[model samples]
Target: MISRSVTARLMMPLAICMLMLCALAGVMIYAQLMVSSANRAALQGQENVTELGELRSVSRALQRDALNLINEPAGEARDTIAKKFDGRMEKFADGLKKLEGLDAHSFVPQDYFDSQHKVAQQLADVAVKANGGDQAGALEDFRGKVRPAEREASKVADERIEALGAEVEKLIASAESADRFAKILLLVATIVLAGAGLTAGFLITRRGVVIPLLGLQEAMGHLAAGRTSIAIPSIDREDEVGNMAQSMARFRDQLAAAEKAKEAQAELIVSSIGAGLGELASGNLEARVDAELTGVFAKLKADFNRAMEELQGTMQSVNRATTGINGGAAEIRQASSDLAERTERQAAGLEETAAALTQVTTGVKETAEGAQSASNAISVTQDQATEGRKVLTEAVTAMDDIQKSAQEIAQIINVIDGLSFQTNLLALNAGVEAARAGEAGKGFAVVASEVRALAQRSADAASDIKKLIQGSGELVNRGVNLVGQSGEAFTRIVDQVTEVSRLVKDITDQTNRQSTTLSQVNVAVREMDATTQQNAAMVEETNAAVSTLADEASRLEQMISQFKVGTRRDAPAPVAAPATVHTPAPRRSYRTQGALAVAAAPADDDWAEF
Candidate 1:
């Protein structure tokens, strides 16, 4: 299937090209409309020119027929000429009407048509006079008026026809020129659009498709070279390239898993060997390597089994020696147990003494702390009482200030009451004046009544406020007195707190001295306790060493028993003998050797597949 990038690259330019084509079509349509308009204008101009020429020809024919009618004898031939004159006049009139019916864009002016109409009328008049037997008078009228007017009208019509013909030619030329320009413009636009589409297609294909494919190729190369961690670009795209990259990503993941599994398999083998060796080092000769291994690990497993077999043989030999050592270790363990028991008893006595001393020291410290806490509490009480006194003093001062403010409020209320009384008097006077105005001041009188009522209410409220202010002032005075009493009470409390603080300070000093004496006694007991603890530690170490020896002997026997070392079932038990001390063998470092083994493996091969 075609990829999304390829589709977009093709469709985008195609769409743009379509739009350009549409625009070019629009330009052609416009050009067509312009040409159509020019053609219509040319046709109309030609028709007008043709009509004007006809009018001029008809005018000349009418003039000729009128002159001929006048020159002919007054007989049958004369009547025929007169009929011809009438026919010419009718034709001239019909032509003039047609010229006038032409559009206003016609070259002939309206005034020129008017002049032709006048000339036609004059010719008709001359024809009428000739038909009435006044031939000489008709001839004179035709020469002096009809013929001259007709010739002038003819000249103007001919000039207008020529001008209209020239205009038609110009319109045709312009239309052709515009049509050519439009075609050229469309051609150039097509070329430019084609070039742009090609260029864009190339660029999009390269960047969106070819470049991504190259990247995918490079990623695949890395994966082939065992670079499992390499990134495959364009995996997010919705195209063939993205599909390829995604496939590569999946391959990379599988490769990574395989790599990880190979490493894990190697690690599992090494860990199994290390675990068996570690158990052996910890005096467990029974430790064995067990794993479902393959490839190189299968060989490593065999080597591990051989090593274990050799180790088992060595342990069997050591087992015989441990049997003898076990007896001596038992005796030593019994002796150490007896010594540790006696030392523990002595340590117990010293521990009790030290605990008693620690208790005594803790009690003394508690008593001193209590005394100090009591002193601090008393000092805090004293300071709090002093602060209370200060707060009470401030409260009393605030009460006095409130009392003064209440008195000022009472004075203001009195002034408000006086103003209300004055306002009531003024309202009463206004009501009196409004009443004097009778019907004209009825509304004013009502307003004045309302004003008076409000003023009376205001006076009543002011009196109430004055009473409340006086009551508040009394209450404030009482509060000031109470605050003064509180201040006195706080002062007494401060004096009592000061006395209690002084007493606590004396007690605190005595307790501190007692605590110091107790601390010295506690130090001496702790030193004795430390010496006993050291002796007990020495006893415990001796006992632990003996127990360890016994455990080692038993563990050695147990370890050798775990292995299938002795082939003969009927062999007698080994005899007990004293164990001789032997220097330990030097430990071999396996870290470098294991690393070399890992490096020696065929890394390039897909071991995980196997």
Candidate 2:
């Protein structure tokens, strides 16, 4: 807000100039728009003239076509002329429709199109009559009617062209008049705004910047010369100059106060503080300021007396602290010795633990190896059982084939026994027929008897074979059952062995993990053992440092006891100072090695494996 008041004076005229420029631009734009509109209208007028001229040309073309069509005889020539006339008619009609769509101010009118249409119709009628063999009548109508109508349309086109030219001239004149008026307006506005801007700038600069700044400058000069009584001007204004005036006023007030305070402090310091400093230099800490003062000097006097008294009390506190430090140093020495002994024992214990872990890790590794071996053996057993199962399956199939073959053999044997019996009956009948004959009958009877015996032997052999096959079939059936049962047993064994292999694999993996875990534990324990040994060495150094501290503490107590300091009102009964010890500044890097925890256990689930 303060800055805006200062800058608005500079910017106000520029804002007015911007507004005036906008107005000038608006006038220029309006002029330009009027000119563009006039130009477009002029161009439209020219197009209308062109359209009128074109229509005249089309009318002439249609007249020629009609004349040609009427003179032609009824043949290909007449038909050709008729086609040309029709095409011209269509072109003329299209022209009339296009002119109808023109703007209201366009030169083309309905009366013009109606006249052209009447001329085209008369020409068409002339052609039709001539083609119908009434050439004379058609010629008369062409001269009297169509020709007159065409002449009238040509006159109308000429008038329309003249009217368009006049309208275009009027539009151009109006645009020129507007442009001239806008130019004059812009010139006058520029001059008026320029004069106003200069006047406003001068007035604002004089009132807002020059007058206030001059007054402030004079006041500031007085302030620099230490004439702080002068009043700063323009502080009530909301401007940068006013803010500077206020700042100057504050600075003057502070300077006057500082001068007064400095003079007072000088007199007060000599009267009161000088003696206290002299006593302090002589190590007389009990001396302090008691004189009363005011303003900043009052605070100074209180601070000086308080400082001297605090120094006296601090010396007495140092004396008591030295005594306490001596006793604490003695305790630290004893504790250091005890800590060294414990550190040595801790190192020994860590070494033993590490050794035990190593043994356990080795055992776990061995167990893992055994489990792996068992897994391999189980896998091999599983494969062998699977092979035995396959063999038993094949054996059962072979037993089945044997039983089927035995039954087939029994059927063949029974057929053989029936054939033999039939042959024996035939032989008996032959023998009876031969006995009824003479010598020939005797020879036939001997042959029949031999044949009968052979048949009986064959039947007995077939019967024996059939009984043997029946017994073999029963044995084969029993063997098939036994082989099938063996195959099922072998399959079960394969499954059990597969399961055992998986169990053994799991055991091997678990044992391996245990071995790895124990190895890590062993390494950690060994590291801790080494670190503990280092800590023991550090503890020996700590004991030596503690002894030195005790001696320094005793010496400090003797030194503080020489100072003359006030006693405390709330003092406790003093403990007797121990042997003297001097303490040193704390070591920059005192490090303690925290013991690492090592997990020690037999493999998890080890006993459960049993």
Candidate 3:
């Protein structure tokens, strides 16, 4: 059960807590929404009451204004009062419309408000009619009909306003109660859920972990204190605790066996190698254990004798090994010192190389950026040149159109000039005929003379207009040629700018490539420099290790010399050496190192021409 309940212990409590919190939140939100709705309704009711009060005031004002309009004589004073009455009428209608537009009016009956506004409209009519003529009749209707109707309507509005006020108060009270109830519910729910959650969490923790852990803790404490004789609880259960308890039991059993085995081994070792131990203590490495014992003791006896023999050989071997180690240590120490110095020199050189490359990279990157900027500027110049060419072309077209229009105007002026010349010729012919008719034709002759003078003036005016058109035509032709020449110049400029832009772009590309290669080389050099520095450090460490090894070898040899061995000239076979350990060289990842030298340059803004 405990094993299967692992997931439950972690998940169930959290699920319960979340469920409780979500449910509480839902309830609180719903309650808040309800409270908000009620509050809004109450506010709407208040607004309606305010609108009704304004309407009632406007109604009373309308009555006074209407009365004034009826009583004031036919004069400016009455006209001014009439305007006031109209304004009051408008205000009264607007107030009624505002109340009718309210959300409260949507569900409430509108008949009460309808009857009220009807009274206001009737009173307006009575005042209007009285202002026009029928003063006595207007007064009769104003008092008997309009006044009574307004009173009744006003009474109804007052009742409605009072009722709305009461309803609003009820809503306000209800909202306050709901708000308080929602707050209480939220608080109580939170407390209850919190308590329940805490209780559930405690039960899960106690059942799953605390109780079992307590038992395990006590058992472990006993085991740590070397109390392995007692039984461990939960060992038979199939759970994590059971597994732990079982492991401890196994450890206790093994510990007891080790103690017994140690005792038996101690007895056998003492009985078998006691003599050899005594000889060994006496510094005699020739002692031998000849007891043919059984089990591990048999091997122990052979081992004792062999150890003595090996000790004899080892002592003799140490004498020669110490001299060799001393010589080797001197040679190694000299070699490592030289290596360290060389490594330091090499590292310094690599560092200098890296620094130089970095500077070169920075310079090249700047050059590339400068080239790119120049290229961009040239491209912009080219674009402007192209746009200027477009404008010039449009100007040329406009100049050509103007020249055509001037030519058309010149043709029209020539037609007018011809017409005026024909008119002058006809007027002269008429005067000749009039002169032939004698005294009666004298008036006609004068009229013909006037006509001839008018014809001449018309011809002169047409001639002037023709001359101006010809001049304008010439100017338009000149303008067209100038615009065409400018267009050609702009085209040439655009071509030159485009070529310059292309050349600058080429330079930028080359500079960028160079900068990229330099940066990659810089990165590679840094990697190599780092690797060289690591090698230098390793060499220093090796020098220290060699020194330590030499000291340890000397101490071991001196210690071996204290033992008394037989005259064993031949040394036993030396032990095979363990594999040497080496630290790997530092490396860096440069994915583009090989390609950097052969590939096209990068177009990055950071790249320089250098």
Candidate 4:
């Protein structure tokens, strides 16, 4: 198409050249016509001018013969005059004959030629009649013949001269007309030659050279500007411009390809870096990359992920340990509460027993003061035990809450671990693809490696956290056991203390109310002591159970803290060309080069010597 445009552009010069050639030919033809016309006019004018001159000379000869006869004796002059008239008349007739064939319109003296010839014939007739007369009579008769005829002949001669003069004027007019036509033809020829020269010059300058070169210049400009998509103008001809346009188009394609390559290279760099960063942030370790740029980013990402995983793992371990410690603390709190509860029950029983003793003392008088003092000491001990039990129960409740939180944390960590594994798999796929991509995939491979490593690291960290949580759970169980044991021991102590109180009470009753009242009081006191011990034991068991629950919560909380489960990497789908399209590589050709070179030349044809 570009070639065609170039050819069309060149056609202007050819068209102009043809027009100029036509003009030149027209001028030449016109000049030739004028010359022919002028020559014809000149030839006809010359012939008429010659005939008129001959007629005038013949008329003069006849006039001279008539004059000679009048000058000599008529008889002697008659014969001579007759002979002269005869010769002159013959000459005049020949002149008339010459005039007769010439165009009358061309020669203005035509009427004069006719009149002179008639007068000359009349003069000749009279002269011939006078030659045979008597001498005197012939002389007289010759006078009569010559005089009148001579006068008429002279009139004709005068008219002939006047006509000849007019003929000269007509010839002059014809010559001038011919000269004007010749000049016009010459002018036209000059103009045609000039037009042809200019047209030829213009054509040579424009079509053969200028437009094609301009096109090439434009193509070069586009190339310089990095416009690889430029399209050359179409030209019809298989000429230089056409070829050049093709070449420029090819060059544009090459440049476009190079541009695409550069773009792809840049994209690869960007994708690789992006993938690497994504992997690192996602938390993978042990990932390695060998990207186009030495895989520095990928390696860095991998290392970072590894460090994060290790840190998370360590945190998880610490969390687990803390959970176990929390559980143990809760169990300890429960056991202490149980022990306190049991002690309180025991103190209560002791106080009751002291009270009974005091009553007995009261009945016995001397022992009454000692018994009262014992009762007071027992009451103080009971109050202290009750306060301690309340503190233990509160501590156990706190431990249970902490354990619940730890369990939730553990669940979250598990989720994070799963996500990390998925990320690793994705990275692995990316790496494989990059590897398969060859040179172009180098960057992607590196990113994939980083992602895989991060995933592994995250998994490891989660595993460690899980272990920690398990350990903490065990510790929580142990604490629970300790609490249970403490609760049981506390229960036994409370029972023993209650029995002492009952016995003391029974003694008081006996001292106060004789044998029957004392035995009944002892039995009622023992039953009350047993009931108090059972109540204390139940409180201790409740405290222990609460402590165990708190420990479990703490472990869960520790596990949950390990992961940010919802953390996600969002990325847009990559763009790709249709699979069916196959882009061919650049090819080499000379046509393009030659066309370009030719098109680059200046179109003015300054080197044309002509």
Candidate 5:
């Protein structure tokens, strides 16, 4: 796999910037979750406060009702007292039951429970008295026993409800405090993370990218100035800069080798030429021009022979020496020109390598930015899920409270029905008494009958109310169950969402790592480019040097043109070789040790004859 690297020029800063962005995003998400939780908690607390208040009101109403029933007059006692007691008892019981269910979290204490139980017994005692035909006894019991007991129970319930209110207040305060703390923490985290990220970016730019490149620039300047011996630091980075440094070292090596080779060849040529001149001065013109004779000597001998034969011994030695020297000087000038051309070619190659490295650096930078963006997105998702969970929990709680309220309504309906039943019985008795009293009781008997009918209607109404409330309770129960299921499903969703967020975070983390690595690689490529550029420049210089040699060979041919070595006295005269001419060979042929370098020379090419 081709591992991604940070191009030294851009990697370090990009990484630091991305990391900081991720941290800031995390802090934002944290704050969002805290705020959401606080809002839900506050809303839930308010709901509890409202439900508690309703329960307290219901308790107070029941208490007042019991007292009013007890205070009724004798005639009213048999009618209103019994009727009211029945209706109120059912209402009180149903209300209490509903209150119990509504907010179990806000339940009245055990003391209240005990008190209410005594109140119920007193109520039952009054009913027994009335059923036994003791109207006065029932009235007395309601006034002396039931009312007082119910008042005590109401007091207990009031105290319990008050306590629940206090608890709700505390929860609200706690949620507010948590919200504040989360905000502060998020702020602090953001500041710290931002600072750290900036610092990291600066360091990366300064040390990892900028500084190294500067050093490389200096090294290159030195090399261009012909200071091949100047030493450069060996940065062992895995980035482009490191690669360039290594490449530069290799280029330096090749240059040094070429320099050495040129020097050695020059010295050998000079010595051989001097020796050949001595032989020519002594008049021994038949010395073989073989490989043993260096470049300088061979060219000198060839020039000397051409001059001596043409001048016909008049100024042979003097002229040959001067021409030989001139030829050697020309060859040196050609070598220099060749070196310059080679150097230019090497520079062009280095430029190409540098361009490639720059591209690598850009790619690494983009990757880092993408990673940071992904991390930020993940953090946001996590916060949303947290808030949703809190809301779901609150909804579940509210539904439970509503269910309890429905049950209380059912109880109140039952009590009303019971009261109506008692009223009907009393009316029936009054009707019977009027009928026994004859004509004087006729009007009273009609009133009694009307009372009976009203009681019957009231009873029917109460029964219908009870049925309605019971149906409501069933619906509420079903709703409660559904809410509970929904809450559970929300919980699961939150869990799954959290997991997905975590996975996104992990992906971002891995991307960050890869970005860092790519930065290093980019740096390496840049270094390689620099080195390759230097190497190519050196190759160009070598090619130029070769061209100079070819040019010098042409000049030697021109100097030798003064000779007519192969022109027979009876044959046509040979034309001097063209300065830049070349003759292509059809095939390659080998020569024996004592034989000439070329085979029987081409008759059409004069340069080949030499």
Candidate 6:
């Protein structure tokens, strides 16, 4: 037997081992975090040291540029040098700010930053003097104050860089020491945890696995040898061994029960077999054995009972079937007779239907061909109508354009008429002015009268042209309206032709479908005629078979009469009724003329009227 509580037995020791390992891991992780912190601190210290060095370098550069700016003559060169000096001063200030903002207060002294600020201020003063073109004075200031200040600031920055470097070195050393310590501690913890795990494993294996398994093995050996009298010693334990012991005890009890049942089953088998046989010998076919026994004996009991049941059931079935067969044989004979009569009548009907289908198929084929021809003609008519509609549409559009042109001509004629009237008015005014000049203007008056008459003639011509143009515009508009009407008529003709084409096509498709369907019907009718003839032959054979079946039923009845099925022996057998034949109804015809009537009625009235 295997241990059932194996997981529980090992859980505590494994859990402790895991916890120790977790603690060791946590210590290592903490050491790693400390190392990371140290590295960050060292990195900040290095940054501060670098900043300090840059600050010192920038201070020296500022001093040099300031000195050069003072020595440069009062010109563009001096201004350029002064700008460079100012840029250097700005850089020095930024370096100081960067150093101050660095997280290295522990390494860089505050007095170093203060000294740099003082040097920046002195440089600023020297830049102001040089920018004012006072080269001599600026030189004096740079020498007297800015140079000394920058030197002092440089000295302080150098000292600060050195101090920061030493601090970084110390941080690096501390990080290395911590790393080494963490490694040593992790190694020691791992060794101790491994030793503990080994010890715990040995103890658990000895206490929970080995002893219990040995006891279980011995108990299983006893069970294997069929020694139910042996004791299972680990039954009182609270582990997998105890469970195994309990299972063995249960198995032993079941075995004892099984043995008892075996003996009982043997006696039952003998008694049941004897009783059943006696009953059978005594003419009681209903006698059966009990099949409630368990294990291997149950199969024996069941088989014996099943055999007796099958014999009894078979006898009873045979006895009953003899009567049913007598009546069923009579029914089959009657049904066969009726089927033969129906088949003969169906064959006659099918022959008639085949002839009719042949005639219908011929008619449908002719109709399909005619409809196809009509469909083609209608398609041609639809195309001509469509072309006519296009021509009428163009005529309507042309009439519209002519109407617009006529209206434009009318407008121009009106403009010409207005100009003629103006010319006539100007000529009349000239005649009045000539009359005011008396006899000296007599000849001028005649010319003005002549000019007025010509103007009047021009006005008359323009008026006549305007009236003609207006009449033409009206006529064109009327022509446009008439053209529109003609276009609409053509559109209606096109629609009618299209509708006729659609209806003709539909008729053609329906005719084709009807022809196809009629062909299929004809084929089916022919096949049905053949099948009916075969059926008639089969029906004659069935009648002979029915008579033989009836004779067999009689013999079977006589044979089943021998078995004493625990019932009265003198019971009367049922007599079969006489057979009867029923005639079937006649089949209906599905001809293509009926389909055409349905298809043509709607299409001719609705579409063909157009």
lDDT of 6 by residue, 347-431 (tens): 8976987787788789989998998898888888888888988888888888888888887887888887788888889889988
Tens-place lDDT per residue, model 4, 538-575, is 54554554455444445445444533322223322223
State which candidate has the highest lDDT. 2
lDDT of 1 by residue, 237-343 (tens): 77545655665566456445544567867467547655764564444545667877776566555654554444344344345544544564565455445545554
Instruction: Kindly give the number of clashing pairs for every candidate.
Output: 1, 11, 9, 43, 32, 0
Q: What does candidate 5's lDDT look like per residue over 85-190, in tens digits?
A: 5776676677557556755534556666566667776766766666566767877877787668766765765565456545644544454455446434533443
lDDT of 2 by residue, 6-90 (tens): 5455456546756876776666666666655765666566566656766777877777676666655678877887888888889
**Candidate 3 segments whose C-alpha is farther than 4 A from its true place:** 1-12, 74-77, 103-110, 193-207, 236-239, 250-610
* Per-model lDDT: 0.63, 0.66, 0.65, 0.49, 0.52, 0.64
Residue 69: error of model 4 in Å? 5.0
Candidate 4 — which residues are off by over 4 angstroms? 1-18, 24-46, 66-86, 103-122, 133-164, 167-174, 177-208, 211-247, 258-610
- RMSD (Å) per prediction: 55.3, 44.7, 32.2, 85.9, 33.3, 41.6
* Position 433, candidate 4: lDDT: 85
Model 3 TM-score (2 dp): 0.40
Ranking under lDDT, best-scoring first? 2, 3, 6, 1, 5, 4
TM-score for each of the candidates: 0.39, 0.40, 0.40, 0.33, 0.36, 0.38
Which segments of model 2 are wrong by more than 4 Å? 1-324, 551-610
Judged by whole-model lDDT over C-alpha atoms, candidate 1 comes out at 0.63
Candidate 3 per-residue lDDT over residues 287-345, each given as its tens digit:
67676566545544554455455445534444443444444445545655665676676
State the local distance difference test value for candidate 4. 0.49
Model 6 pairs whose backbones collide: none
